[model samples]
Target chain A: MKEQDDKQIIIHVDNLVKKFGDFEANKDLCFDVYKGEIFGFLGANGAGKTTAIKILSGLSSPTSGIVEVAGFDVYKNADDIKRNIGYMSQKFSLYEDLTVKENIRFYGGIYGMRAKLIKERTHELLSRLEMTDYADKLIAEIPLGWKQKLAFSVAVLHRPKIVFLDEPTGGVDPITRRQFWDLIYEAVEDGITVFVTTHYMDEAEYCHRVSIMVDGRIAALDTPDGLKQQYGAGSMNDVFLKLARA
Target chain B: MNRFFAFVKKEFLHIFRDYRTMIILFGMPIAQLLIFGFVISNEIRDAHIAILDHSKDEHTQKITEKLVSSGYFILSDELKNENEIDACFRAGNAKLALVFEPGFGRLLEKTGKANLQIIADASDPNSAEMLSNYTQAIISAYIKDLNMAGYGNKIIRAETRMQFNPGLKGVFMFVPGTMALILMLISAMMTSITIAREKETGTMEVLLISPLRPIQIILGKVAPYLLLSFINAIVILALGFFVFGLPIRGSLILLLAESMLFILMALSLGILISTVAKSQQVAMFISMFALLLPTMLLSGFIFPIENMPVILQYLSAIMPPRWFIVIIKNIMLKGTGFLFVWKETLILTLMAIAFVVVSVKKFKLRLE
Candidate 1:
């Protein structure tokens, strides 16, 4: 039970400071993503969500921080973090030239999946998502909704403990976005912690817990209901607008 | 092994699907070879020449016939006098004027010597020099033949046989050089563009975020080009032998192994370029200027590296294509064995190792 409980703190970011030259992008920021929860990290365009995500993704080194993901430190155990986490970007980041199955296999292959398992998982995945019909189609030929689902599935195909989604629903239709949230909910239900950064307040409401970044620090961090009730607002959208304007 | 094969299969599918890549890889190199071979030449043929004969004797008439038959010079006009030489040149009707001094046959018979002053246009020195040299050599040979026929007692003799490339076809030189260039372009430039394209389309991030090892990602990206360049090497060799009449005088296995080594070196260079480049455009620009330009210009493909300035010569020496050109030329044109080409092979092997090391280091740094 203790071993499994240790997995609860899937990601624990401490007093993280990221700087580009003299400018501090993420300063004295701290947050934690519990296991099996959809945690929304929200910020405006320049509010430093990307910089923090970059540091966590092992794409860039943090200026100073104790960044941990999937029970491994970001600085020292990056290889472990790599194995333990998956990322989906704002771009529906599947290989357009590749067929849906090939993209899944490619992603799975990268994570060192066995050929048999990759093939098996691909079959299971396509059938589950009802993407079996589009499995042989090139990613470009598929509809946008299917591409979005494929990108999300590919990100988590390796069965990582946590998935980092950097605006995974950008340019996606509202119907697909809602469907996308259902997929996230399904992953979380399977004990895969979801750490997502988004500009959408409605999406923020769907997250079990949400943190809003304003100017480089976490301005608000709580449940959607807790934040709205505390801020005397009826919705997450109003709470965000009031805080952003402030 | 299966994973590697699967990765290679995916790479081939990517290449086969992209029509532009198929054209650039299979279509361009052969076209380039044929275009440069049959369409262009360094040998000057039928260059304009004006004749000035003081004595229009049988000897001079026979000499003109030999010169005309040699195809080195076209007799543009008969020069009336020495004064007309300048006018003929000024009128741009001739690039060279031959002046046969007065008493040409008389002097040759009595004094055993005759002067043929060839005043050639010095603007393009190489072609002019070749023209003059051909004229002199042909005239000397004709005189020698005349002497052997008992017309004269001069015993100066010369015999020549063109060794490997008897017909002296341009394809003999260009075949190996084109193979070097095309393989390098496909392996280095095209591979970099493909890798950099993943970064451009935002797919690289997703792949990296997945469970795929960085090594597998790189191997997957480069494997297709490796197979392609190898097949291209074979195609060029077959075309050179069957179509263009070039021969492989040395061990075929050694040539193929060395060609494969050179391809690896080029692909490593492509990987190195992709590491520094942020997007496909940057990758392509770097591959063109940093790899393709050096591979083509510095490798002695079109220009002799020996004739370049000392610094450029040294720079060219470091280029893998330079070593590859020497190796392939030795194998194909010179028909030299492995003993002769092992040093070049070693150089290419070391270069491939160095490129892979630097690129892997850069890739690690980028991830950091």
Candidate 2:
């Protein structure tokens, strides 16, 4: 990546702390995501990755922190932040009962898009995903890989400045994951910042920069090669194992 | 307006797409109405009775004939002595037994009084009570006829006028009650289950993150049910009027306005229930137990609340359908104007507002 001065910080989180009663889920978390970068958030189960992401997505409030997403404060300007960002949850975000085109139009319409723009984007997105033939079919009848791709496309349909994907490729085959990464890269190429959380070690390697959270704190943050070099590991998986073991 | 319409359209689609739910939503009201109208009745018809006539006289025979011809009692058997009364009831051959004193006719002629006893099978208390009432009415009418024909003298006579429902048709008693039940079931049960279904399927999370306000989400979920329940109320009222001859004594506009108020109250109750339930099954269970049972039992639907124990009568006051049933019966049967029902309307309005406020509070808490 270029030097930090060349890129603008899109998501700025500083000293983020989230507590549920007395249990601190996120402790003194700090990170900055630059514009047009694929920032990977990596962690094991119960490592506070989701808690921090939820705060950034304006889904939850932090106990004590300064978080800014899409140039809006997390506390007072959540609605403005929500208007500028997109979210695709882990649980198959689109309605399975609705047809593909209907799902796209619904999400777009809820975002306050005009009818003409939604219709035009519906046509463009279906053709670009090469899913034109399956446009009228219910999401339940579509293949898993195709649904995943469509879900990503729908998430970005409103042209939000940044899109947050929480474990977007869990349980997919490796070839589909690769194709899914191709979609992510395509989204990144359009100058859309992609913030994603994943368990896949190899997927972590594909991020421009990755943050590894261990026990509610960022244990390591660096590029893939830099992380591997610092840990004297041969691959991202070995580097993750080293940090997770520590 | 467009987004709200789109959301409501999606809700309607969900309702129509599932044939099973559609059938339940539309079928249950009619089924309950038919069951209450025809299968279950409080009026007595052709009850069996046995006669124990100790006096072999014309006066006793005349009383027996009058009771038999009234179409309320069938003379199933004859009892020679008092001992056979137990056998009649034990064998289930008679629901009541009429006994005459040994010298019935001679005593009435000479002393102006004769003993006539009625023995009713009290095991099924309802039918037993009805049978006894029918017997008393028939005897009183016979006495009045005798006096009128100048054969006897009477001191006083009490005439009863059954005003609204002179015939006491069971349909008149149940129409308002059934309207309350149907509206409560459709508005409260269906809305809670629908909202809970959205939560269970994870679509609620998607909607929450969207630009639509939380109140809009709730209103969108409840609007279709409100319309549907209103339609059901109209269908029930139409059937009650055209098919069952049930009358609406008051202004039709006031009845409809009151009905809409009750529907809003029920819809808000549904929203409150949905906020408490995390899953569809839980929502259904809550509506069934918390809403449906109380509505049917405590609403004075099948039973009169005045006759209930003091605690239950107080409990009935808290049930929304109880007040609704009162308002409907007065307006539809008595033809009372809004001036008579304003108190009930006001109570329902306060309840609706309270439910909506609590639901909004709960929803905001959930977001936090």
Scoring only chain A, what TM-score does candidate 1 earn?
0.95
Write down the TM-score for model 1: 0.88
Per-residue accuracy of model 2 over A1-246 as CA lDDT, tens digit each: 769789999999999999999999999999999999999999998998878778888778888989999899988988898778888777777877788988887888778888899999999999998999998898999998889899899989988899998898988999999999998999899889999998899999899999998999999999988999999999989988999998
Stretches of model 2 off by over 4 angstroms after superposition: B53-65, B78-84, B101-111, B154-160
lDDT of 1 by residue, A1-246 (tens): 124356467788999999878999998999887888888999899999988887888778898979988888888888888888889888668888988988888777767788889899899889989988888899989888888888888888878888889998988889999999999988887788888999988898898888999998899999899899989998899999889999
Give the TM-score comparing model 2 with the true structure, all chains together.
0.94
Where is the poorest 10-residue window by lDDT in model 2 chain B?
A: B153-162
i-RMS values of the candidates, in order?
2.4, 1.5
Model 1 steric clash pairs: A110-B211, A110-B212, A111-B211, A111-B212
List the DockQ of the predictions in order: 0.50, 0.54
The alpha-carbon RMSD values of the candidates against the true structure, listed in the order shown, are 3.6, 2.4
CAPRI class assigned to model 1:
medium
The Cα RMSD across the true interface for model 2 is 1.5
